[model samples]
Target chain A: MNATSCYETLGVVRDATPEAITAAYQRCLGELRASLNGPNPPPPERLDALRAAYQTLGNPAARQAHDAALSPPTPAVSADEGERRPYPFAFTGEGGEYFRIWIVNLFLSLITFGIYSAWAKVRRETFFHRNLTLDNSAFSYHGNPIAILKGRAIAVVLLIALSAAQNAGPFAYGIAVLALLPVVPWLIVRAFRFRAHNTSYRGLRFSFHGTYRQALTAFVGYGLLAAISFGLLFPLFYRQQRTFVLDNLRYGSAQFHCTASNGQFYGIFLKPIGLALAGMFAIGFLTAAGGAPKLLLPLAFGVGTMALMLFLLPYIRVRTTNLVWNHVSLERMGFSSKLAVLPYFGLLAGNMVLLLLTLGLYWPWARVRLARYRASCMSLLSAEALDSFVAGESANAAAVGDEVSELMDIDIAL
Target chain B: MIAADYFDGRSSRRHPATLGLRDGTVVVEGDFGRRSTALGAVEICTGADQTLSTIRFADGAMCEIRDSAAWAAELAGAGIGADAVAHAERRWHWALAALAGAVLIIAASYAYALPWIAGLLAPAIPQAVTQSISDTVLKGLDGGLLAPSKTSPQRQQEIAAKVAALAGPGQLPPHRLLFRAGPTLGPNAFALPGGDVVVLDELLALATRDEEVVAVVAHELGHLRHHHGMRQLLQSAVVSFVVGVYLGDVSTVVAGLTALLLESRYSREFELEADAYAGRLLLATPASIEPLIDTLLRLEQAHAKRRAADRGGLFGATDLLSSHPDTAGRVNALRAMKR
Candidate 1:
């Protein structure tokens, strides 16, 4: 995927008027609806994405931001942003202060037997959002605790039903697994909506507008293909999934455009698998030549697994971040991540060692370090003020769907 | 007077403004021109950001000051303050005190509360549920790694009768004594939380004496008596809870994986308790703890032989070979209690 600006995504030209943009957005939605292969209409992310494009293009202020980002040499937009230097996201949460809040929240949750976890969830989300600054402004979370509790109630009931099904008999368990297969895509959509709807930047809430049919097609349809092909088509599935989800995302009314390609996904995946295979071949040859007849098989298996994990895990982390962020843009403001394989690999491996050595007390520091690195590594390739681009949304998605998602522990958001 | 930055909330333009109190009103003068509003007209959010304090007008125009104290000073007499920062930044003493309190609470819960809860909940589970669990597990195992026991049916029944006789007076009559060929789970015996005691064919063949096999059954019986499986599950849930509280994301896959990884793993204490229970149960049998001790040492040796044979080394690295408690220590402890 390349930088297909929101205007292009909604099928509008650079100078399209507000009325023209709205007409284009509606046209885009209708085309999407006609293209749906299911009984259901487009998912909220799809509509939200189109709506975001409409919102931004419709508003004079936001339009100018997009225009400025599109044509940076214009000089007028950058002047208002105060500083033209590269701005990195910043986090100022101290372990000590957060620890106090964390422990209190934990203690309350324990006493309440998980009832207080909703409140804890809100507190923690709010804390992280408040600390994370993109440019000078920060993000905010506006999830409702009572609504989350209700969602959790539903989730717990579902979990009980699932657990019961597992022990009910083999036939019932098999049916349960098959039933859950179709629900995974729907759950992902709900989770995306819940997350996008609750998160806000500059008084404008985030939104997702992908259709349910699209998700079903991507997850279930491609899921079957991947399974049949030993996951070789997984890159294509990931490509579709990310495109639908990320491209449909909106911060206020600005539709996000994801240009991440399947080829890039394959590139990231295959490199690690290739490296691991090469190491495996070397180890296999050495052991086979040594004449340690009895030891050969077990050592090959163990060392192969160890090498694959060592190479694959870090490779995926770095390359996937580069693939996603470097290809994705909100309108014309590009998102980029500078994560390297070695550093991240070292961080994860060392963190594991530290966690084991400290008997888990190092978790807080480890978490902070990871957060700081990720935050610092991510940067926006824009000089325009980020807040100026997204216009406020009018639609309201109830808190229930998001809460339900929370209960199910579904997460694809960043 | 506090001169701070402002945005119209509709445009990206910044307003350089000086803010002051005017009795019943708050006055602001900036490059966008002078404007005054009733003090109640604006919503004041202190600590909206760690460094920025926000004042939002009903009309969507907003101003933010960097110094929280400076913003608070202007609004001190108005009594319209949402001091979220002061609340978060309690004294160092309070922070330390809370830390100590939290640590104590976590420690106490893990040490006592979890075990108590598991104990309370374990008895309520019906035999039907446990039977279903055993059936599913055995059925799944049979389709793949496990085969029918090659041992003669007559030998199987003889051991089954011993297990049943030993389990006769127990709180839980062991749900079922099952056997499977041991290609995968070599020389292993385990009790699922549902009370089924499964002995592998390899372990059955390795034990030359019936007393040795009976001792293993008695040990498995101890696990059932204390509901070790259920307790292990509960303990893992509690560990996940602790992790969730700290990470602040209970819903993430990473968090769930962490919980799953921790859940089925037993602590050294659980293993020791099970061992002690087995020792007490076998005292009434013909060989006392001697056979149990002999079985433990032999199993350890058998496990070492398998690993050493496969890897061409590291018989000394027995710790890595097994998740079970140290067999030598267990044997010594069993010997010490042999009076």
Candidate 2:
């Protein structure tokens, strides 16, 4: 009768044979049907009770338990209950932790004239690795942090090479620049592999097998569409971006299995539409304001919208990166996690506008949002717990500590 | 179990702790609970307080107390820890998407621009067109433009004979002329403009094969004719000049300029008047009526190729040369020959 009970529908004794149970269930259904056919049927209450009782004891384990309970001693807890593994981790708000790392990374990166990107990358990787946990089991960074640093260095080198090539003559430079078309996607795949290899949760490591060319082609193709359409095809472009990211993402040592609904998959398209509409409204409003008001409106809207968007940025991020694992295994982790376009564009546009207006004064705020955005992507319970522990220890510790000391502190005079 | 106990006791507090027996030699604890029996002095506490009672041997030795729990928690909280490491795969995918978007946009923009740009630069001499013209002109002038006529029977054959004679000695092969009806053929003896020109058979019928036909052909020879092809080319170059002034290196500049050019339309009628000039040349020639009539018939038949070439014939209002007189009426006037 209970909503949670799955075993009650079939009528059979705990020790009944499978054949006997099937026969009994069929007979009960027959009786119910015959009664309904008769002019005067059994009361609805009796039928409902019968149905509930049958539903409850239909499952093999529940039938056995019911039969056993009617006899003498109770049996051990059912395997169903015992087999239900608790979720290893929980979601904890660690925005501050994320904020701190982001700030430190930003500061270091700036101080070193962007030279610290390698170190920043390593630190960032380390921070994310330390925070992630599964079923109380924390992940360990077994691969060298230097690998991440190395990857960043490679990226920097490639970037420098591209910039140099771009400055070269049109023909030679164009070829060089075009040559980089494949490199970015390649680096992304490599970086993912490197990062995945470095990470392990409960001794299970993860890796990605995404192809650089496929990712590159999809991106280039969508970009072409956007350009050909004069940016009018942004919705389609955004959808492609989400699909490529989600479909390519993997988790666990064994790939995690995931299936996203059409609704969920295409939900990302709404973001661009929303942003465009918002941009249009903003521009229109500014235009209508006229003269001096118009000038200030853009500046005000730019700053205000940016700050507001930054605040909502985490939600957008969480929604986009919403990944559900069908079955995460020890050997391969396969999962589908979407990287939504809305949050990314929102973050980018917001930061760009702020940068334009404040002349880089908004960099810190942007950095904080960026950190939060990245952290939002991570699924780590322990990191959240640790964050809470830190916050709790700092916020109310004076009171709790004094009370604890009063109780535990021993006095030699006594 | 023994190691556990030893480690537990040794790690009881932050301060250094030691154990010994009755002898002066310090006793060292070994695995399996075995210990050396010797007397020794051991410092349990260096400077740190040893009074905290909660400190126990089972708790493991305290290394440096760095308050790094905050940093560790922050790292963990931000998914900078193992969890973040675990998610490195997803991050890579995200990066890939961003990269793909960038590349696609650039490539597509270039693809869309190619056809439009090509169309804009269409009038510029295609290498094929320039080469063909050069070959045709040089062959026609192979006799050094003022060569003494040994091949011709008369005192001086017309320019057509001279050029045809020169062509044979110069080793320049003549191009085949395929005729089709054109709307611009009139009393006019017209040149093919480039590559090859069709002379009207109607004009040829009006004059003797050698007299009127040769002179009419000479004018065309004057255009293919003495370096006129080169001069027409110069005029075309001047007319279709492109100012490659870039406003800025930005794509917006190119896009705006292209949009403006696409909206602008060119006027027709310029080519139609060129047909009239050909007619004036034919009138001055001493060619016969039969040759002129033959030229007209030939031109009427060959006009189709001109219509095919332009998509709109010279007489069609939308044609580029439509401003000139109708081809049919001009032919009628040429037929009424009073001269």
Candidate 3:
């Protein structure tokens, strides 16, 4: 008998009724039972198989489900059908709803002397993850609070040790800082692994496959190069870091590919510097050429500097996010982002203003607002069905790296 | 029965299903298949605000119940209730209570707890560290806010000796007096962590008599004796650090400025404390507390004049964010102490 279906196992056709299936099951079981006492007795496992088949096909609900599973899948939408519009990511989180969670977390954390912070982190991440949807499927976070607490404890200890070393003397401080240099890359990699392994979409977990050696080269070696070159090589370093992170990321069986070039990163960072320099030159030309009053010179410089400062950060952030995400792909699925610089800057400025006005009470609302805006600007650049990807082998990553990096304020975009 | 999305965990496939609890078994029947597992065999993750409850089977299959209310009700009917944290998070009143509790706790800690902790901890810092901090702070101020003293060497020595006589000997951390020309700082005197009393030239010029200068230095010596500088540093460090922890996503500039404003209150208390110390010391000497009172009045006049001239840079941060106590309060406190 074919083992593929219950009907086949019972020597019955697909359209067999419940009575027919039960009869087939009874006959098969009797035959096996009667031969049990013979020298060439049929195995008892055959009887068990017959009973199992009978059990499933005997139930109407189970039979209907079985039939559905056996049916062929519907054809996927073809690309040539002109239905290739990207799927927009949506954030359904509300300010008032999140504020409750944030306040409660804060209160608990304080009362527990910060021990509850680990649980708070889990809840916050879960809140964000569950609210974020792509193509109607939400993501999920499954981080353990105990792991986070342990990591935070270790990070606090390290922080105290570092401070103590600083007070001990220059030599001790140097040794402490130098020791941390190697650990930085390790922590970065671990953080990536921990974050990715815990995030899930459609029951398939994301993962990071980057090794420590690669992280060190990207974060430390290139970081040193950027620093030694007085930040001239910073764009290259940034590209390397992003590539190292993006290229190693995996969603189920498909690996994410980042085709973002170093030159693109250079363009993202250099344009602002170029604009600031031009503004400076223009100001200088006006002042020297007697185009404006000398009394307004300091004001002009101050305004110019402030404008440049405001423009630079938002511009770089928007351009880099668009550059990196737009060039990223997971198998046939691609990513897109249209985060405009001015709107982002406006949002941030408004958030800061309201934050000040409310004396930090605007924190939860600000986060929700930012999350909504960010989600709006992002999309999946694919028309292909999302269910084709398979789950990969799951692994547990220690939260120490993630928590420590968080404590150190190292922002690694996922 | 609750409608849910089920995943076999072998692939990223969604199977629309209906889940039911029967005889301690969770049965998920859907288009794809039917899975019935003993309730005790599956893991149930509690739901929170707007998040679904997840039920995981031993074979890596899982189900997500999207209707939080219905799922919660079902779980309750089945004797599986929300966890303690989730229960607390479910209510608006609890959240508000937590907020009130947190605010009260933080305020109480800032007002009473931090001062007590800093006072106990400040004197316990190693002497070498305190000395290093003093040197670093003064060096950082030099050549920028402070220039070399323009006062004649003789006058500087005379005032230093008078202040030294006031402090007396056998002070655990012996005091050292230094003079600098603080044109930018303008009529200020401060004590450092390791018993360094710095008196600016502008401050000396503001005084009418030599005894007034000694009184000002004597006030700074009071700060040294109480380790107010070190205590202030410790308190502010803790404040900024806690603010940073609590507001991790906030801009560092904003957090630091907020910490600074909050810390000004503590500084005012320290100032008044140093003033009382100065008043007591002056009462023991022939100069009396009259000079210290006069110096405070003079400094207040100078500060007000500078305030008018500067037009309140950074939106009058100088007066609003001033670390020093108001002159009236300091003078009144000193007068009361003198009696």
Candidate 4:
């Protein structure tokens, strides 16, 4: 079938301004309307042809393609495209294979008593790189093996030191040993940078900039908060951790942006905690009131608290992390939002209480909450325009491919 | 020009143009006397001949007429299509709600049944009362149920020797027993219910020091006297009989017990009755009151440590357990002389 030509329907020259194209489209539509209801009405076929022509040319991508087709072809190919033609890396069981690789790596590390953590790390990196594709271009790893080994070696040493300190005595040297745990965070940052630098998509090498000290500082801050609040501050702690990780992570040449609104996010996070406290207070007051009536109050309070938290928790998370997208690229995307405290607390408390009461029946409940929470925090958009080239068509025709395709074989003469 | 008039309720104007004919068709002449046939219909033509004549239908239908003064109005309202709006899945939310409901059910069951069970079992078997009855039975066998004479200093030493001999070499010496006089304490003697027994001084005065005191001490020894103390330790350590009694019905017990344990305060009378049984048992032992009396005093001193440890393990706080009776009261009762 002959594809519709977007440029002809829009009545624009090859180098027409976007404004001029729009005006011409409006004029052509006006003329078509006049012809349809004039003293002599146009045939039904011509009316259908006009509608199809308008639809195709109205879309932007098809019009751009059609314009590109009308331009003269360049003799020389771009350096990037010439050196690395996009490759289609198709594997029948890609998802399953990646999952198996993760499982096997985990199992091997476990069997070897964590001696294989370094191997597992490399395997994970390879799996991730292999799966990532851009315009049929698969990423390849060119990371330094020695750097990875060095990072892993540092991590292992720290782990051993921590273990030795914990086992030395209940009190003696344990605190001193724990002080050295910050080294692990530094090693992780080094390892991430090493891995990212090795990943290549069409020769555009991926890199990340993160500091071990920063990660460690964030961890300590989170720990302190958790301790001070008697673990009630877990939601806030997690939010900080998430923000740190996301902000620190970089893909290819782009860096992610992370910003959180403390007040708005905390409002959501503290909701469940407030509800729980209120329920506890109510139960106490009712018990003090005395008689059979006092006995029923606690039960009602518990049930009501649970019900309210269950509904509000998800709502709070979605509202809190409905991230606003300020920037994105073909190779990278950044997200920023405030951490929600109340929803996290509600979800955590409600799930824990329910799980304890029901043995394990609430596993699915926990799973769904986690899934919804993840969905709330994540948003994806393709940075590059979705454009496909037609071999024989002009750029303008390609750009307005939809419009031209819709007008195929139609009689434009009235 | 096609003209029609109608009243519009929403508009402030008294009369408005009512477009569209009875058959939903409107045909009018355009500029330069050109005849235009608008498909649907037009009923009202109120403006000048140069006004853009158009047809608007009930179903959001608006078709522009070219340079026409009059045209049909086929009003068509734009209704939202089914595909345009997406329905949200509330299944996950509902599942979470159902789980929360289940948690509430279990918590409610625990809260309701536990206290009822505790109340039911508390009245059936009073540990203090049973121990007192056993003490009375042993005292009758010992020849004097009321009073036992105080032993000589030399005799006290000899009795200690005999208890030490019976205990054997490598073993620690038998706990001492003490005898004190107290008329209001009644005919009861008690093994301290821990590691020693105290014989009442009134009962000691009623009998000569040797055989009666020996038999009383022997009976008290039957309890603390051997692995019985160990048995009590094991029972108290391994089982939560109090909790079991309170939480026997799994459905309605847990929630109630948690609430009670977290909130309730026990009475002072409960401690005194337990002490009465210990006094009665000491009177039945074949040993002297010196060991029992010494142990009770030592217990009173060591009681703080035991309480601190228990509170640390159970509630992780000491202030919460402050309402319970202190050890000083029981020690004072044991030291009281005949009055």
The number of the candidate with the highest DockQ is 3
Task: TM-score for candidate 3, please give it.
Answer: 0.76
| RMSD of candidates 1 onward, in order | 11.0, 25.9, 9.6, 26.4
B52 Cα displacement, candidate 4 (Å): 59
Ranking by lDDT: 3, 1, 4, 2
Q: Model 3: which residue pairs collide?
A: none
Candidate 1: CAPRI quality band: incorrect
Q: Is candidate 2 or candidate 3 better by TM-score?
A: 3
Whose TM-score is higher: candidate 1's or candidate 3's? 3
In candidate 3, what are the lDDT values of residues A1-414, reduced to their tens digit? 234787667766565445446655766677687788876887667777777778888888987787787753333536423554688999988887888889999998988999999999999998899889887678888899999999999999998999899988899999999999999989999999999999988887898889999999999999999999999999999899999999888876567899998888988888777887887798889888998888777997788777877777778888888999999987667788999988999999999899878888888999999999999999987666677666555678999999988987898865
Q: Give the TM-score of chain A, superposed on the true chain A, for all candidates in the order listed.
A: 0.77, 0.47, 0.79, 0.46
User: Would you estimate the TM-scores of all the predictions?
Assistant: 0.65, 0.32, 0.76, 0.32
lDDT of 1 by residue, B289-323 (tens): 88888888888788877776677444233333245
Q: Compared with the true structure, what per-residue lDDT tens digits does model 2 show for residues A263-373?
A: 553464466457657866877766776644546756866876655555445544455455332222211122223345567667877886876576444554665566556
**DockQ, all candidates in order:** 0.17, 0.01, 0.50, 0.01
Most accurate candidate by TM-score? 3
lDDT of each: 0.71, 0.41, 0.83, 0.44
Candidate 2 lDDT over residue span B1-339, tens digit each: 111112222111112223322333323344323344222132111111111101111112211212233323433443334333223322435434434443464344333433334334444545476556655654553333322223333423343453354234544223222222222332234343354544443343434455545544543543432233343444333223211222221235554554334322211122222323334445544543445445545555545445676763443533322222244654555555434
lDDT-better candidate, 2 vs 3: 3
- Where model 3 places Cα greater than 4 Å from the true spot, the runs are A1-87, A160-179, A224-235, A261-308, A336-346, A381-384, B31-34, B37-41, B46-51, B135-191, B196-221, B242-260, B275-324, B334-339
- Tell me candidate 3's interface RMSD: 1.6
Clashes of each: 16, 101, 0, 107
Model 4 misplaced stretches (Cα beyond 4 Å): A1-117, A128-157, A181-188, A191-203, A221-240, A290-321, A324-379, A382-414, B1-339
